[model samples]
Target: MAERLPAGRLVAAQFAACAANHVLPAGIGASAVNLRFLTRCGLSTARSATALAVKAAAGGLVRLGLAGVLLLAWPQTPRLSTTIPRNSLAIPVVGCIAVAALAVALSRPLRHRVGRVARRVLTDVRAAHGRRSRVCALWGGCLGFALLHAAVLIAVVRALDVTVPAGHVLLAYLLASGAAVLLPTPGGLGSLDAALVLTLTAAGAPGSAALSAVIGYRLLTGWLPLLPGLLVLALLARRSVL
Candidate 1:
């Protein structure tokens, strides 16, 4: 029931989607593109939306788990000792979690509403994949992007003449980038820049050096391809591919 585009157009649409993701807030661009792609692949609107939501939730959970592991495994460097709070941060985090849990527990109507959506999503998944393969594939792609993003951070730090542990940089990038998702800004524009700079500085990098690294990372990952991606989007749109 969905229209299929040529391979070239499909690739163009993907690039355009990536561009849109960098240009829009709250990841709407990526979600829109993904839904469009899935629909083109013959999935229904509900199934495509459900798949995207499931992928995002799964990615968030994985990032959170990774952050926890990094916090436990890595020792706080001396540079971070003064700026990082050990006890104070946990209280707010725990309180927020408790409040959220209590609210969810108390709101039966809300739960029922969400339950219907969840059931429908599951039905769509079962009808398509019969297993969790689609979710797994989405997870794999998310992890791959995170790793590449971390690698970009490492490169930026090194270029700025900063010496930090590779593992630490990777962990910091992962955590900061994940946190940036909470603030919806175009391509995480200002929000991501601030978060990454703060994160790197907290990780012991000099503030100025961290700022430079963040700028470089953003230029490489967000800004550089923006125009090209838009151009691709235009091409696809003109060809009636998107």
Candidate 2:
């Protein structure tokens, strides 16, 4: 009986810790996600939209910084991708800018409606949690962390010496990651690798190259990072911070 109590306490503490560590980032991601959907459904706000955009930008900068680190540590690693033609780069960059401008232009009216919807969603979410709001916050943090991660995955893949278009990689990731939500596994382990490989292959990458890239990415983004997460969870458990 005593043993069981300690185990239970351990689980609860880790859950609490994970939740506590993840709120602001998750809220930022959720707000952006919410605004994206709400805009389509007739709700939007500059303040909310801008907040999410900033979070996205902050997240992007973090990835860019990581890329810079890779350049310093393993100069050859970044060469995994094919060099983009100068002409192609200009067109793609222009297209991305146009899309951003369009999104902003479309947001003026949509933002007002989204604010109301966000308020309503919050009310219901709060009601659903009742006394468990902290748990919800922790989950939100995990979510923020995940969204930031997905963006990084696409970025890393591009930064590697590959030839596929970034847009295609992003789209493939969006679909696979979305599907991974309902997949019954911790961190979508097998599904994510499968999805990434298949998506990359479909985008015209050779089997060997795709496999190598995925393996390298999995090492950095998965196996290596997990050691730390496990260590953190373990230490937290011993300290009864679950």
Candidate 3:
């Protein structure tokens, strides 16, 4: 399926659809069955959002950490500087240059190390804990998701016939996304919307145009992804795929 589609998108979409079906809030009753194997193996069976949330946090921290290093080395980074903005968030991403040539050793060591840590943690919890642990390949997932989001944004901006540099677009996304993390609202509702307006406007995008772009992007990333997921949950609940 992924081979039939461009850029492995179908595979991502398929996992997303399946997860949405199984992980809906109403599917709480069904989740136990789908996750029974993990439970039998004595692993975490809590919310899928738990792993995704951790991934988001890990993504922010890793990107911020990388940005800090770059900013220190070149304090007065020009708005046009292409180095960090293009790849800052990607530093921790799996299969990237940083993960390969740089942290090759850590990547291999983490599996064994994480397995040991997971066992120790589980040992302490025993039967008392109701929720299971949810550890994912967070760095890679976030990078992939972010890339998908960025691709949409770039496509929109270019579709609008704008000549804005890619650096400006990426910088706006990173900064706005950083602000989105600060707010407590689910998925940075109001804050992210505002940040998009402000960042794009600062980059000379007209308020109305930028607002439209942001709204469109949100529909794709937020509502579009979520609604189908919700439906999947509903259908799975009715069919018992939880």
Candidate 4:
């Protein structure tokens, strides 16, 4: 934001948004809250949206980069096995591309909006790269975010006395989390649990241990902060910070 905001309020806003995220699907709640906070802090809607886009893009790239690096360094790490034919996979991929192309071709407003957003994102990316502090904050925050989540899973695994290696646990978390994005469930509810269990089990942890890890992870990440998060949300609302 160009207009300076109080750091305390900014932190509160983030806490409130994190709590709000689990109540809605695919983080819509968090995005809406952040967008509102940015606007309240005096940014235009387009700029706020661009900022969010940059953040999301950075986080996604970091996850992908980490997974790639881990896979390369530890080639023995288990990968998700699928029996689906390679040829069959192309059908959905091509269909998605075709559908997107057709929609863009036929919808004038959608095309204009997409073009505008693309231009804004490019401009913001260049501007962000020029600022060393901005670059550090963006990538560092994303990397830290991913690592913290992985640490939680690792802690859970260790607590349960499971025999999975830390590298395998981290790799499994990254892959499962990346896959969970496709489902768009609230806090990745069912989708994350299923993917995590599968990935952990595939990584050679026993089925029982993998399931326990998922439960423990969910309890920490989801159920634990919920009430306090809601309380913080209420406080923010009362203080008119949101």
Best by TM-score: 4
Q: lDDT at 88 for candidate 1?
A: 39
RMSD of 4: 2.8
Candidate 1 residues lying further than 4 Å off, grouped into runs, are 1-11, 77-113, 124-136
lDDT of 2 by residue, 1-242 (tens): 00012445434444333333333332333343334433433434543354345445444454444433433554442322222222433465588889866775789766666667567656544543455554444345445664566566666666766787655554445444434333424445666677667656765667777777677767766566555555665565466343
TM-score of each: 0.79, 0.42, 0.54, 0.89
- Listed per candidate, the RMSD to the true structure in angstroms reads 4.4, 14.2, 12.0, 2.8
Candidate 3 C-alpha lDDT tens digits along 1-242: 00011334323334344444334332332233334322333345542333333444567775565445544554454542332244533443544654545554667786666567556545433422333321223455656655567678767877777666555665567667765544435455677778777777666677787888788777777676776656654554464333
- Candidate 2 vs candidate 4: the lDDT winner is 4
lDDT string for model 4 (42-108, tens) is: 8889999888877987898998889778878787654543311224434655888899889999999
Stretches > 4 Å off in candidate 2:
1-147
Q: Point out the worst 10-residue segment of candidate 3 by lDDT.
A: 1-10
lDDT of model 3 at residue 52?
32
> How many Å off is the CA of 148 in candidate 3?
1.8
Model 1 pairs in collision: none
**Worst ten in a row by lDDT for model 1:** 79-88
What ranges in model 3 sit over 4 Å off? 1-42, 45-54, 65-136
lDDT (C-alpha) at residue 136 in model 4? 84
Candidate 3, position 76, lDDT: 54
How many Å off is the CA of 209 in candidate 4? Answer: 1.0
Q: What is the model-wide C-alpha lDDT for candidate 2? A: 0.50
